[model samples]
Target: MAVSSSLSSIHISPRTPKTPRAERLEDGEEDVELELLGEDERYRATQDLDGTDGQAMEAATSKQPISAKDKRSMVLLCVLYLIQGVPLGLALGSVPFLLKEHLSYSQLATFALSSYPYSLKLLWSPIVDSVFFKSVGRRKSWIVPMQFIVGTLMLYISLNVQKLLDDPGNNVGELTFIFTLLVSLSATQDIAVDGWALTLLSQDCLSYASTCQTIGLNTGFFASFTVFLAFNSEAFAAKWGVPHLTLSAYLRFWSIVCYAVTLWLLFFKKEDKEPATEADMSIKGVYKTIWTICKLKHVQLLIVMHLFAKVGFAANDAATSLKMVEKGFKREDLAIAVLIDFPFQIIGGWLAARWSRGDRPLRPWIYAFWPRLGFGLVATLIVYWFPKPPISMGFFAFLVFHTVLSSFASTVQFVGISAFHTRVSDPLIGGTYMTLLNTFTNMGGTWPKWFILKGVDLFSVATCKVSDAGVDIAVKAAECVSDHGKALCKDINGTCVTETDGYYVVSALCMVFGVIFLVAYIIPTARKLQALPTSAWRVKMS
Candidate 1:
């Protein structure tokens, strides 16, 4: 909701009275004297107080919008969100596979290079916020140019992957560098898109707006990843004949298409009315305001609960696909399995929409939470028991089950957090608050990647040794060399460096983090729901 009315809280004290007689008598003022303005004129459609009747004016402006035009903006922006997600997720998942398999680069290195740019984008958001393109207005200004750049890079990457791989003399490093730049550009587009989403939505309908936004975003993401998988598979058998790198090339092609569509959209989007944003929409202010919100006792528990919810997700994302791989699924097969879960997200979104129709208390929303969490645990068990099973009809069955459970958990999480954030954030800094919270969640997801990777690597090496002689740094270096290659094992500043075994390390990290989160965040969140007043959870709305 881009709507802001706190600016209307203007005060005129005894010491600072209303406009002086002379000032009030300016030529323009004579057109409609303050006294003649009347009750209705004073407050009509205003977001701020001015001239006179500030509080009285605000009361009138507080009415919810009834326009059909305004309502449709949510649906339109949701479509954009859902569409953009495909390119984003395709890039997120497929690019790494392409690099590791075709180019012989490491997945960790590729992910950090590709994905790191997105997380670091907070650095540039202020520029996006404060500055709008003079010709196209702020949102369009940033979005249009960046969209072209992302598209161009995707096309470029697709065409050049082979040339770079064919010759050791060629510079894959430059290709990676170019890819990083496009990521930065794409992330800026994300920032602008979010701002656009906020502006189009009204203050009165934030809950609905956010629900649609999440659904659209997840829908786009799921679809894009599926498309990526399908395209990757089909491309693997295509004329390019670049086996391992096929998906990456196809993803690049997809990015080009994404950029092209976004560019086309640039022409269609209307210019936004100039709105005061720094005083209203800045992310820096969120840092200060989040502290203030944290002090509320009732809300504080929800915030902690919010923090706890991520433990499962954080652990799950860090290792799930790799686990699936270890369980003998091919990358293409895994991609197909993931594609099967898309419908569950829609189901979850529909349920949330239903829940929104009633004025129910937040607790009965709790019923869905346990089943979602239980589904995750069940899926995990099934996978573990059938570890390394062939991809059969039954395997697809488990895949659907796991995906539905995962989607349910994701739905519950989205609806809960959106509801929580909407309550806590002041309308004055709502967009800023949401972005900052997203940043925290990003940290939650990212911080554990390497730690998990390293710990799992160490455990795997030690388990393999299992000797009283003790595995020294040299032994670890040898193991590293064995796992990766001799080039990866080297000495730095007279200290030994080794390439950690990725398979064992990834498994160990997931298991450990999964157990911790299962006990800590998931259990506590469950407990909170159980403790909720009985009357709160029984709303029969969809």
Candidate 2:
């Protein structure tokens, strides 16, 4: 009898087909066909000597079936991601507005207060990944206790008053620190959820889950934020004798719900794999696996890409609410406008993926310079749209512009990321392939905010009203005039407009970079596809 060794699908090789044309694009889909080199090359080995062992390893790992239990876990994990958005929206974006109205701190400080916790999540991811208390029991383990801490933290904030509202002399630093601690704990819960999620979802399903997760997060956040805002600003006021609870207090109440849910998950679930220190790890350990992935060509491209993709939209993502406030849009109007825009966003993302799935080549994203140039034209037209009014509607103007551009590009992005990861995941290392993608994806996510904050500091905001002819003036005075002129020019009557320069400039810049990257991302991806050895596409049976 011959001894037989089944392929062990514990490792993966990065030999997926080159990114499809639709996926190569950051904007719309790429449209290149994978034209393999001649028939002779059909059997040519894509795995050179350097990649052969890796390819075999991948083949071993790629086909593992996800158990039904695991699938359920994965779905639950994704829901957590979606659920993540609610508290995030309430605390991060909504709190800043409340703070702006109630606090003495300058604009920059207010922004920092809200965003600090999210940025530091990386610091805790490691800890969350490593810790396991067996006595606590199950995959959920310590999550129950953490939930209590998180819940109590929220409860504390919910009942508390905003110190900034009363005495200007009150210490904002202390209040914000406490707030950050609470938020940090909340973020830790997310890290734990993602850790658990990774274990639950099958490798093949990660991208789908991620896309769903993204939508869930954004949708949850928006819904929760809206509810909170309504209660804090409107409903709370309607209550008898009670000082309408502050936004902070409402945010705390929201946390209570999250914690309660978290506790339930703890009782119901347990980790699939317990903590393994480096000493306890296998021959090819987590660090080694991660290191191998980081060294791949596509991973490098992804890292650089993380910064570039977001840099183009840095101002658009983080500053929108504040920008709207500055632009004189009422909060209520801004809220409504966003509600309208978000649906379009979700639709755009779904269409990009679903549409690209058709057309054989599956080029869902259309990233041509010509199309983007057309976008630039539309942007310019928007700037010049309608008659100039006396008051500034800069906020509304910017919102509409960003909503259009961001949704269009981001939809394509959602698709591209899915396609890219799908292409990258080795059919052999079914689950681990997804793990690598998620890790890389997280890295990509970090850069945008990093670049955005840097860009905010690097760029100066200067404004000047258009004189009969361009006139010389002090920059600050011009900026003041520009700001005031913008504020004075808006009405629901649509009768007044101002000559807006800022949004127009930003839109133009977005187009410029959009076109440049579109060209850059497309040509190489197209050429790379055409160069892949035909044998790479062959279905070789061992």
Provide backbone clash counts, one per model: 7, 33
10 residues in a row with least lDDT, candidate 1: 1-10
Q: Highest lDDT among the candidates is held by which one?
A: 1
Candidate 1 residues 1-542, lDDT tens each?
00000000111110101110112222222332122122543233112334346434323433545467556776665665554454456445554444433332133443445455555565565566556666676667776777677667667766776676464224556655765676577567766666554445554344455566566676666555554655556544464464543644565756666766676667766665553432323344434344544443433445455444444434345445544554566666666666666666666655664453222313324445455445546555654565555567876776767776766666655664454334323333323434444444444445555454444344443222222345443344423312232234332212334334454445444555555765656555644533322112111111
Model 1: CA > 4 A from native: 1-71, 99-110, 163-179, 234-256, 274-309, 353-383, 387-389, 422-431, 462-542
Q: Which whole-number lDDT from 0 to 100 does residue 120 have in model 1?
A: 57
lDDT of 1 at 481: 19
TM-score of every model versus the real structure: 0.65, 0.62
Clashing pairs in 1: 86-224, 132-138, 354-542, 364-536, 364-537, 456-505, 457-505
> Candidate 1 at 98: error in angstroms?
3.7
